[model samples]
Target: MRLTDLISPDAVFATLKASTKKQLLQELSDRAAKLSGLPAREIFDALLHRERLGSTGIGEGIAIPHGKLGKVKSIFGIFARLERPVDFEALDGAPVDLVFLLIAPESSGADHLKALACAARMLRDPGLVATIRATRDHDALYSLIAQRSKPYAA
Candidate 1:
């Protein structure tokens, strides 16, 4: 699945002030709740539950925290660039600055995995990650993700 297919411009935040991994997930979940109009607490709780299983940090200063929620009708994503790096227990043992939060319908099966895989593949590109880090506004950041995720569309 294309990143743009799941994320709206409103879900993107340019400057996220999360001092730690927990706070970062909360911030992202809150944004997703706002966009989806679901209870913020419920979303936060669901995402937190997923994190408890394991850290979503994919390494290289990036993390993709994802969960399934009953209230959601489709997959949704939120992108955030933290003002400072935070320990996310990443595989590379490095802190994370860029985060991608994904929420999918509870009934979704392979689609959720497909979306996460698509995001991970897109984020694996160093140049694209650098470009995303350089983005100074939400619109620009959303555009960058949209552009990068285009090639994977099927």
Candidate 2:
């Protein structure tokens, strides 16, 4: 799946402010609620429950927080670039500055995994991450993530 397929221009954010992981998740949950028409508290609780399982912080200053919700009809994602990195208990001990929050319908099993894998692969590209971090323009960030670009740079 392509990033553009899962994320919309309105869902892309830059230089978001959050001092802690919980606050960050809360912000994301609130945004997701507006986009998905679900209760913000429900989304927050779902994300919190997932975090209790283990940190989604996949290292290299990135975190992909995801959960399945019965209220959501399909998979959707929100990408946010934090104004400053925050402690996420990342496995590699790196604080997270970039986050991609994904939520899917409860019945979307295989589709959810595919979306997660797609987001992971995109963010794993160091060059792409650098490009994202270099700009605060929401439109540029959206293009960088949404465009079907060439091979990932090393």
Note the clash tally of each candidate.
Answer: 0, 0
lDDT of all predictions: 0.85, 0.89
Model 2 local distance difference test score: 0.89
- Residue lDDT tens for model 1, 11-97: 788888988888887777777777889888888898889889988999999999988998788888888888788999988999999
- Model 2 clashing residue pairs (backbone): none
In the range 1-154, model 2's lDDT, one tens digit per residue, is: 4667678999999989999999999999999999888999999999999999999999999999999999898788999999999999989999999999999999988888878887888888998899898989999988888674333221
Quote the positional error of residue 134 for candidate 1 in Å: 1.8
Q: Model 1, clash count?
A: 0
Cα displacement (angstroms), candidate 1, residue 109, comes to 0.4
